[model samples]
Structure formats: C-alpha cells, structure tokens
Target chain A: MSTKTTRTQDILDRTPSSIALYRLLVPFVIVGLWELLSRWIGPRVLPGPVHTFSALYEGIQSGWVIPNTNVTMQAVVISFLIATVIGGVTGLILGFNKPAYDIVEPFFLSFYSVPKITMYPIFLFIFGVGLNTKVGFATFSSFFPMLIITMGAVRSIDDVYINVGKSLQVSRYQMFRHIVLPYILVQLVVALRLTFNSAFLAVILVELFAARSGLGLVLQHAMGTFNSEEILIVVTVLAVIAFVINIIFYGAQQLLEERWNMTSDEQMGI
Target chain B: MSLTGLSSLPYSKQIRLGRATLLVAILATLELVGRAEWFDQLTYVPLSTMVETAYGLLVSGELTDDIITTIGLVFVSFVSATLVALVIGWFLWRHDKVKQVLDPYLIVLYAMPIFVFYPMFIIVFGLNVFPIVLIAFAMSVTIIIISTANGLAKVPDVLIDVGRSMGLSRREQFRHVIFPAAVPYIFTGLKLGFVYAFIGVIASEFILSNSGLGYQISWYYQQFQTADMYAVLLIVITLAVVVNLGLIRIEDRLHRRT
Candidate 1:
C-alpha cells in the first residue's frame, strides 16, 4: 500500500512540472511560426513579430500609448473600488439581516441578469460620452457579482461560530470583527477577483462603444487608418496587462485560501 | 433560529411580499422622479415616455429585425465557440505536453479583452456578421476551454481506475464517465459563454453595424433621441433577462439529470 501510494504521488509530482514546461513551449512555437508566416505572407497580409514589436515599442516611446492606457486604467480602478465598497456593505447588510435580504435580493437577481452593454446608450445619454459614463458602467457591471458573492460568503458561515461569540459575551461589533469578518475575508478575495474581471470587461465594452481616449480609441483609430502594427501593439499590451492581473489575483486567492484553510483546520483540531 | 415567523404567513410568503413591496417602492420613486422632471437636463424623456416609445418600437419591424439579427449572431457564435472549445479541451486532456504549453496562452487569452481584436477581425472578415460572430466566438471560447478543462481535470482517479479494472475501453470510459461528470462544468462554461457572446455581439454592432439594437441605440444617441435610446436599452435589458432565465432553467434541468 505504501509503495502504491508513493508511485501515485510520484506521478502527480511529475505531471505538473512537465505540463508547465509544455505550456511555456507552446506559445514560443506559435509565435515563431506566426513570425515566419507573416514574413512569407508580406506586411499587407500579415506583419511579422519584429515589425509588430517595433511598432509597439515606438508607440510606447512616443507616449501615444500611455495617456489612453492611463485613462482606461483609471476608470477601471475607480469603478472597481466603488463597486467593492458598496457591494461589500450591501452584501453584509443583506446577509446579516433577513429583512434586508428579503427586500433587495430579488431586485439584484433581475438586474444582474441583464446585459449591461445594452444600456450603454442610456448611460451615454445620462453621463455623456466621457470617463464618467465608462466608470458608471464599470461600477454597475462589477457590483452584482461582488454583492452576490459576499452574500453567499456571509450566509455560509456556521451559526455555531456566531453562537460561540455570543456565549463569550461578545458585543455585536466584536462578533462582526472577530468572527464574521474573518469568515468572509476569503470570500471577499474571490469577490474582488470577480469584480476586477467584470470591471475589466465593463471598461473594454464602454471604451469600444464610445470613448474619446483609451486603448479602445487607439484601436478604433488604427482600424480606421489601417495601422495594423499600432493595433497589434496596443492589443499585445492590453493582453499582457490582463494576463499579469489575472496571475496576481489568482496567486493572492490561493494564498488567502491556504491561510484560511490552515486556520480553520486548527480551530477544528484537524 | 427565528425562522418561524410570528405572522400567520409562511416564511417564503413573507419574503416574497417584502421583495414585491421593495420593487413597487423603487418603481414608484423612479416614476415620480422621472415624471416630476427632477432630472430634466439629464434626460428630456421620462420613464413613462420611454416605455411608450419602446412599445411603439416593438410594434415596428425595426426592433424585431434587430432582435433576430442579434440572436442569430449570438447563437452562431456560441455554437462555434462551444465546438472549438470542446475539441481544444479534449486535445489538451489527452496530451500533457500540449496542455502544459497551451495553459499560459489560454490564461492570457482568457484574461485579455478579445474585443480589442475587432480591428484585426474587421481587416480579415470586413464589416459584416462574420466579424461580429468571430468577435463573439473569441469572447466565449476561452471560458468554455477553461471550464471544460477544469471539469475534465476534476474527474476522480478512482473512477478511472475502476473503469480500467472493469476492462472498459478508453473511449467508452470517456464517453460514459468523463463526459457525464463534465456536463455541469460544460454548462457553466456555456452560461458564461452565452453572456459574453451576447455582450460581444452587441458591442460589435455598436462599433460597426448599421442595423441591430446596438446600432439603433447608437443612432438614437447621435440624434439625441433620448426616449428612443432608452426604449432600445430597455428592450435589450429585457431580452438579456429572458435569455439568462432560459439558460438558468436549462442548467437546472441538466443538474437534476446528473
């Protein structure tokens, strides 16, 4: 049995690293093949990696990319922050109080199902074709998922934990701070990741629809002018930024989950 | 602990009543403020006017045609995306090396806003439904791949071993065990894919198309026809809600079967 278990463990250990290396290799090969094909096909049909890289570098060096990217990121950050605070507070209220949940939960479900991009024109009319419109959409987009996740997280906490706090003569505030907060912290991280994802989509959608300045604007202009190189550069940068953000958030989630698991295990004497 | 209400009504009924009251209150407030012209500078048309205009638009063939076009685009894109994702996901499941190598790319693709590729798509496919479909497909494919792959990865080793012990062919085992287990995950992917595809289709319409609800909304915006724009917006929102509820029902049915 011990030997069998060891063999299984060995297989598991070997699989992940080999998989990682292969994952790394696939992109390089694809990029290389793409470069070769582009070179063979000519710039009109396809621009080579070198040309695209140069264009991207030039755009960055000339400060053409920075301003738009900055504006987009600003909208994303501000909207995400606002969504987080509002969603968190509302979620807590609903989760903790049955009356509030009963009153507001159905409304959230109905609105959450709606495709927000459909409302872009209304938002444009209300806030005009500006940063506020973009940010408003982003906030709206991020709010629902965060609110839902928070409610779920809060609701999932064992009643025993709350009872324990009460038994210890903990004040309502103390109960929330000591037990409720920590219980929801891990879930909050999950909600934050989701909120960020939604916010990113919201920003992109809004920018694509009507934006005077942003990466979307840059792409729109490039398309209009047939500036393939510039478009590729902007796209590559956005992809990289998105990739980095996802990786960071994923890592953070894993770390938080591990810590929470450890603490919970200790409490349970497991 | 206090789940049993003092009132004669069941807890669910009370909850429903509370929800209904809140909805009514919100709608009333919105109607009052809208009709009162509290935000006249912001919107020239009130909510009531917007609804009337929306009803008129619904009667017109314009709204129907746009809805049909958008739905067609969404359906086509979703089907293609799901097919592509299934093939890719299966390939990754079979080959450890390929799966590893493609994981980062997949992650990057998943995170990256594929909407940015609209220009490239247009350059390749032009300003037609083809480009819109491609955009929607790109938007949805990543979610499908992720969910499908995750689903496959989550299959129990014991189940595989049991199948092997039972002398089941690999293909048979995959069809019967792996596929069934992955249904829920695939449905999850489908749900997300549909939502994204809906958004992508609308976004594409907004960016380039001369027709469709998105185009209509944009046209109304350009004309400063606030009531018409709001009407279009309401229609879009209502359609989305209906589609979402439909998907949810499908998901629930599938879950029950599994």
Candidate 2:
C-alpha cells in the first residue's frame, strides 16, 4: 500500500503548487483582515493598506526614501563583506589549530555572549557618526556567529579523514584545499546566512541610532514627525527586501547541504 | 614539558584551564595598558574605573529599574513568540502543503531586520512598552517557527504509529509523542529567540524610548559621562550573560528530563 501510494504521488509530491497557492491565500487573508481592522480604527490610529501603499509610492518617488535606503544598503553590504572575509580567515585558523582555539575561544564566547549594542556608543565615539562608524559596528556584531559556526564545522571533521589524508601522502596545501576547505564550505554557507542577518540587524541599529541618511534615518524622521504613512511605507519596503534576501539565502543553504551530503555519500561509497 | 605529564590532565580540563589562563592574560594586558598612559589618546576609561562605576550603577535604583523593564519586556515577548510559533508550527506540521507554501514567507520574515518595523510599531502602539514588546516578539517569532517546524519534522514515524496503535486521538498523539520529541528543538529555538528578544527590547528602547538601560547608556554617552555610560553598559552585559546562562541551564535540564 505504501509503495503504491509513493509511486502514484511521486509527481505530485515533487510539485509544490498547492503550497504556493496556500501561501498566497494566507497573506491575502491576513492583509484583508488588517485592512478591515485599520479602516474600522480610522486613519489617525491605523492607516489602511491602500493609504500605506500610496504613501510608500509617493515617498519613494519624491526622492525622500531612495538616498536613505542606498546609504543603509552600502553600510550593510560593506560590513557584511568585511565580516565574511575576516571571520572566515579567523575561523579557519582557529579551527585548524587546537592551541589557538584554546587561547582565543574564550574571548570569542564572552564577546558573543555580550549584547553588542551596549558597545555601540563607544564605537560611535571612536568611529564617529558616519558611514564608517555604522559599518564598523555592523561588522563587529556580525563576525562572531560566522566565526563560531565555521570553527565548529571545521573542528567536527573526522579524525579518520585526517588519517586517510596522511596515509595518502597528501601535501599540507592539498589537505587544506581538498579536505578542510570542502568540509568547512557547508558550514560557511550556514554561517553566511546567519552573518548576513546579523549584519542587517547591526546596520539597521546603527542607522536608526545615529545616521544623517539611511532607511533607518528616514524611519526615525518619520517617527519623530509623527508621519505614520511615511513610516509604514519605509518599514514595509525594508521588511519586504529583508524577506526576499532571507529566502534566497535559505534556498542557497538547502542546495549546498544537498550537494555536500551527496558528495560525502559518494566519497564514503554509501 | 613531558607529553606524559600533560596526558595526566584530562583533555577537557586542560582545555578549560588553558582558556581561563588566556582570558586572565588578556585582562591583565588590558589593565597594564590602561594603567600606563601609552594609549591615553584612546577614548576609554581605565579597567578599574569602569569596574568601580559598574559597581555604583548596580547599587542604583535607576539602573535596577531599567534592567527590570528590559527583562520584563523580553519575558513577555518571548512567551508570545513561543505561543505563536507553536500554533503556526503545528499547523504546518499537520499540513505539509501549507508548510511548503509558507516556508518562503517565513524565511523572508526571518531575514528581514525587524528594527525597520519599529516606526510602524511606534505609530500603531505608541512610544511605550507595547512597541518594545512588539519588537521583541517580531524578532523572536521567526526563530520559534523555524525551530518548532524542524523539531516536528524530525519526529520519528514509528513513535507516531505506536501512538495511533494505542488508540490515541490526534491531539493525544501530538501531546504525548510529537510534543515531547519536539521539546528539545523548541527549547533550542527558545534560546535563540530569547537572546534576540532581549536585544530587540534594548535596541527599541535605545532608538525611541526615554527609559530602559539602553536609553540610560545613550544619555550618559551624550553627556560625555564615560564612566556612567560604561557603568550602564556593564550592567546590561551582566544581565544578558546571566539570562543566557540561565536559559542554557534550563535547556540542559529539559534535555536531561526528556
């Protein structure tokens, strides 16, 4: 019975059309409810979706929104890149060397455990309130998860793999490139997703806290001026952008994991 | 040093000892640099002064109140996030097609910087605990959903079959089999959710509010009262560490019970 069902539904199982439809319907239902509620509550307290969408459109067209978004994206992208390179290198070094891990692991743990925003003011004073300062803060906040996850991934490699490489007379460089590098790549993908998320949060925090131009700055201005329409538009755009990025990265992670698992299975003759 | 002598110490203990020594050495170096005027140009108070100020802040009622508010907000948000995640997660679990449809949406929602939504929250909820709590909830809810879904998905099929064989209702099977199996995953999600919620509350307060530890830190920093700023920062860090450790302990205990 199970085999027959599996065979019969193989094609249907592969297609997620129903799921996609449900997803679309759910959001519409939610938005419809929100629109109804907001209309009932009135514009001053809760603006309807139509008003919010129009406000967002107008705000963007007026050039009030784009500069801020560009500035914020610039900071986020730069910091994210810096964090990835620095964290990847540091993680590789620590993961490969047991003594170094013992020496530096504690500091990383302590710092990671601390609420990073608490140190923002100090960063502000040092770096000043500009693009560099926001980027610096974002980088610092994002580096930890990448470093830790990468280190853990590297450390978890089987001793048997190392022994096998040794038996094969693999050169140090070859061992690193073939065995260590590929092993860490899977973990790195996961780390990248997390790091990107952290970087976004960090950049947003810095921009909101003190920025002359950025999406955060615009949101702050809207809040201060009590411009609910503008605020709604900016936030909705940011949320939509963030959501899209997350979905892309999640798909990448899934693909990487599948590929990695397949490669491992083939290598093990499983 | 003889390899034999080193081998006498357990590997875990050796690692712990080495880590502690490294931390102490780093702290000592910081103290020395702080004591010497070598980096006087650096905008930082000496370690001793910061510690002293931190102690003072700990004794103050204002700082205490701020800490309490932050913690209260985290707890409220975390509970709501957990409940929401559980409901959504269960729905997804019971219906695979729904899970597939919503997976993309959830991932996107998870990735988005929730801080961006603060303005909307402020407009809707006002510049009070509600906005802060909402921020925390928003930050945490995604984690709960992801973790809960993962947990439920990982439940062994055999267990579900056994529950069914015992004449358990769908709800009973969920409560008796699915929930217990999913608890660890849920707790893992809770741990991450709690951390994000804590940070979210503080961050919201920092950006918009006039009260809370984050606000106090910002206020002190703006006033150029470095000591007071450091003091508040220390209290905030201590609270975060304590809360994280407490959560970890709870997770461990739950894991053991399961």
Write one digit per residue (lDDT tens) for candidate 1, span B78-150. Answer: 9999999999888877765565556546655766677877887777666788889998899889878877776
Residue B125 of model 2 has an lDDT of 72
Q: A217, model 2: CA deviation in Å?
A: 1.3
Clashing pairs in 2: A243-B108
TM for every model, in the order presented, reads 0.86, 0.88
Q: List the residue pairs that clash in candidate 1.
A: A22-B101, A23-B100, A23-B101
- Candidate lDDT scores, in order, read 0.76, 0.76
Each candidate's DockQ score against the native complex?
Answer: 0.45, 0.48
The local distance difference test score of model 1 is: 0.76
Best model number under TM-score: 2
> Candidate 1 chain A: minimum summed lDDT over ten consecutive residues — where?
A261-270
